[model samples]
Target chain A: METSSPRPRAERARQVADVLRQRITAGAFDDGPLPDEHTLGTQLGATRNAVREALGLLRAEGLVERRQGVGTLVVHPKYGHGLDRLVGLAEALDGYGDVVNEVRSVGIVTPPPATAERLGLVPGAPAVHLERLRRLGGVPLSLDTTYLTADIGVPLLDHDLAGRDLFALIEETSGRRLGRADVVVHAVTAGPDTAALLDVAPGTAVFALDRLTHLDDGRPVDAETLHIRADRLTLRATLHRGPA
Target chain B: METSSPRPRAERARQVADVLRQRITAGAFDDGPLPDEHTLGTQLGATRNAVREALGLLRAEGLVERRQGVGTLVVHPKYGHGLDRLVGLAEALDGYGDVVNEVRSVGIVTPPPATAERLGLVPGAPAVHLERLRRLGGVPLSLDTTYLTADIGVPLLDHDLAGRDLFALIEETSGRRLGRADVVVHAVTAGPDTAALLDVAPGTAVFALDRLTHLDDGRPVDAETLHIRADRLTLRATLHRGPA
Candidate 1:
């Protein structure tokens, strides 16, 4: 491939990474001890400085590891966690006792433009918006909002929603089973509303989770938006490599 | 199931969602036309107000859509896009078209605590930290830092790197093939250095991509931390709902 100009340091790092990559891929070295700087410098006919720099580049690319006394070793690929678990949120929050629920506001109104578009409803369709400040052990963790078409459970307006299992309520009232969900995740800073709700300074980092849920029959049932503190939540996935 | 409380509004919305979800999952509703608000309200024995609120909930979940004249309909789930592509940096740069490179600092030094831990090297291991400003075209995009262990590619220090392909050079010089990578993505705000490089005001939102690369024989080779403009870049993944 023809080369384009890159920063001198990047070029150097790339060069070193390539050399190490080839050796590892070609099975030239087992997953064991890597040559020390002195040996590698002499073997590659390069100075120790150059070899060390190259090693840094490889480390940045996750290619080589330098153990304290064991030397550098080759590692394996990591697979992504499958999303079919259908049981992560509860598990993640498990053992964290007493999540505080601050009911920011609950009201019936029309869906916002974005919500309307997703629901395929006419603009200004009547809807209910419930905003909550969720805390773990009294420390705010997330600011979330739920929008629901009003007719499903008209009986809900009068209840104290400050504490309750939303899903359980629906099953009991309508005899409907909750099934699958589709989720979209992204990073965002706390907007004005979330900032106020979570009691964080505006512009704090947050993980946004947008979810669309369905029933056993494939009907869409619920949609929710969650803005969670990045420092508190850990998102992990297991992945598999393909095509070598 | 016995009624826990009389939250009429919440209940109505939940009931409607239950039916809609059940019907959709059962294939009774073919991801198509949802009953109009008036009809759904009557069937659920609730007012249009209640039904509308329920629909709002569904919309938030990304399940239903309401068209101007078309009424409401069920929505299909968005699929996952794998992270296994190993997209080239050049390709990623071209996709944005404004990637600019600013060499924050290019010099040899000892590895940091975090880098050393990940690379399994001792802290202060002789390494080079090359911090750069990565932009798309002329627009500021990300702040990146790459650390290369010394003795790996000191030859890089002698070359001019204003526009080069680091990976290509590495492969050519070392004869190594690039392999799989593991990435950890999270949301964060630009720290002082990143703020300057990205030309964004301090404390602006940014997405952090922490990546580690390995060889076929599973040797850790390199690690890099990328700070990207949150609004501009989107990391998407496709989730496969395993078979029922």
Candidate 2:
């Protein structure tokens, strides 16, 4: 007579679990009420203890669940969201009312290192700067900073910036209508400056969107960075399998 | 006597900026060397003082740059990476040699309410649980936890999990092939559990990818959450012009 080697308690449990895992994944065992411990043990030709141990292993893997009185059951599948689209946050909250943007500060200053390179500017050219704290119904959401060339709108800083739309103001004042833009998004935590501006807890998680707008001729003209709360915003993107 | 109202310093700069912005965005001013302050001021018939103030505003907005002793320049547009794709990190690093995955534990348990709903799992069922820390070149890159249906893989715990591909193993063991998946990406600070597993500093900024995979038949198979180093990884995605 052939005999299988005696297995340790843990090993026995593992052996039984392997068999059960195969059956469930193979679709032989659909997601529904499972056989009782005795029947499963007898069917697999293993002890009830071994069957129980195997079931324990499955539970931890987020695969199965066991109710107090009810038998074990199976779970269906799920889907997740994408992050590539250049959608606007304002658009994301289109239905939500009471959206208000609080103007933090609006002034002119020099460009930072990365910003200067992106804007195709001289190391020392004059530019117009605007900063604001965006809020929805008094709840702070994001901190935005925008830059424009001085030659384009020399008197831009004197506008009623707190109430006016920037792109519209640029069109009216400079005669340069708003066009398309390119954007970059990244995961980031709130730095001291952003934390203070957004009034969030220090070291909280945040999402950052960096964008550069261009004219119809494709010349880069403006740059803006929007820093926002991560939890409050849900970034979604959909991709097509076909050609770009 | 015809007299024009004297413009404030801020207002004068803004006006100068509007003309320059219009010209630049219209491509009349390519992202190239600018005319000298005296020349530009004379051509615009504006005082150099007002021009300089306007330039200052643009610099702060990151639209233009003032290199040390160099002239102003325009910046290039930046691109953003989205988290909505259903790509696997292990697959992302396939160019590297064999990776070592240390299986921390496996057990049966119930998922949190949110996770349960996301996975489409019943309130009570057997969930297979697995925790692993992923490493690259001996350095920890991510820590992940996955949950699946126990009934799909009864003897799952005893499988040769170490160094085994979960997807491959599932196909071979359960005959369930994955067709598509949905995912969510977010920025977060390392918590205690994540810090300990990935060996990262607590409160360090990290990107989190939460995902759910489905079979070709549209059955949800597994749900996973991955915590990765934010600075070390750059997420990328491509988008076309138009709605999905």
Candidate 3:
């Protein structure tokens, strides 16, 4: 196991902070404010100073807030989206809230060479391009841009897009079962336009995902780029160790 | 398909940019500066203005540079780490460079409540805590903090910690095969101390990963938190759509 530096005082505080963070995310404090520092210290078997430092760490992480007279309160924790399975945003966020799609545009255009190659289309072939701003409970969550081979994409233009996931529409239009996807995730600072669309400050950190979805027979069918609010979502996965 | 807003000019520019980005990443220009805008425009069947805007967009993405009297050049691209597999840092980064572990500390300590629970230990049980600063090609990449069950962890104290991965060491020490891990990934701004250690500016974006590893019999054994440099790594995964 790889380890961190062993500064005793800081380590104690980090451990305390870790415990508190888990508690906050688990809704241990959802019903009310966190206990006083001394009380937390006694419960966690840490010193008052350590508990204070722990709270400071949580505050810096945007997990908690200290009010003038209200004490420490847990902030809304981020939702976890599983990465192990291929699911649409609405399916992944089921039970959270209704996901509404604001369709920005839909048209046929010649895709860039790389996109054409990914979709196995001729270099200059036309493809359907779509863009949407997605919201969860009215708060902007992501800006999604998608490209599909014209055969399936053209039919989608006439379908209802505001209340359904593209994955479902693609399957329905093409009558082919979707199988797998290749995804890449990284972090980038939001640009001016993306920031405005996501309702966040310019230069705010955002999660950028590039995905290529394929049919069950291994034909690549959809290419997508999504810029998501980093503060609102976390990616989760369960990975297995292959045989050595 | 859900599409993006269609301002034709901007869309053209973006399409051109996407083509250039693929070429750059594929090492088409690794040996020299990119061709002049006119040549690129002619080659891609795009207007000179669209090509110029595309170059500007690439410049903004830090993937290219417009030097004095020189054309655009590709910067170092981020390495892709597969998130679909449970692999150690060195294993995941094979063929990239040597991954060296700076074992900052290793000792037994009482784990935080959450970590203890994850590792299937009593709340106040002692566990082996280890901290390491991992570097790839001598550049700091991640700071890993780990807690392990003492039975297997205590025996690891005498093993060579710097040159090998903990997964291998654990398997050797405990005579048990590793199974799977649950991981959660999010983005955060680097704190002052972490920034100093990772040699990045404070408030720079970082990827934070929390993971719990289990044995073949489904006993959780290791808990870890890792902070990674976002600029240096992109997480990749192949996901399958299960039966609806």
The model with the greatest TM-score is 3
The most accurate candidate by DockQ is 3
Which whole-number lDDT from 0 to 100 does residue B177 have in model 1?
63
| Runs with alpha carbons beyond 4 Å of true place in candidate 2 | A1-84, A107-110, A121-128, A148-189, A212-222, A238-244, B1-84, B94-99, B107-116, B150-180, B238-244
The predictions' CA RMSDs to the true structure, in order, are: 14.3, 15.0, 3.8
Assign candidate 3 its CAPRI class.
acceptable
Candidate 2 chain A lDDT trough over 10 residues, lowest sum: A74-83
Per-residue lDDT over A50-87 for candidate 2, one digit per residue giving the tens place of the 0 to 100 score: 78877875553323468778786543211112345433
Across residues B84-198, which tens digit of lDDT does each residue of candidate 2 receive? 3444555455665455788776777654433455567776655776767777667676667677776654456768666765765676687655656665555666654455566
Q: Model 3 lDDT vs. the true structure?
A: 0.79
lDDT of 2 at B122: 72
TM-score of decoy 1? 0.54
| DockQ, Cα level, model 2 | 0.11
lDDT of each: 0.55, 0.57, 0.79
RMSD value for candidate 3:
3.8
What stretches of model 1 exceed 4 Å from their correct place? Answer: A1-88, A98-100, A103-109, A122-128, A148-192, A208-221, A237-241, B1-100, B106-108, B122-125, B148-182, B239-244
Worst 10 residues of 1 chain A by lDDT: A76-85
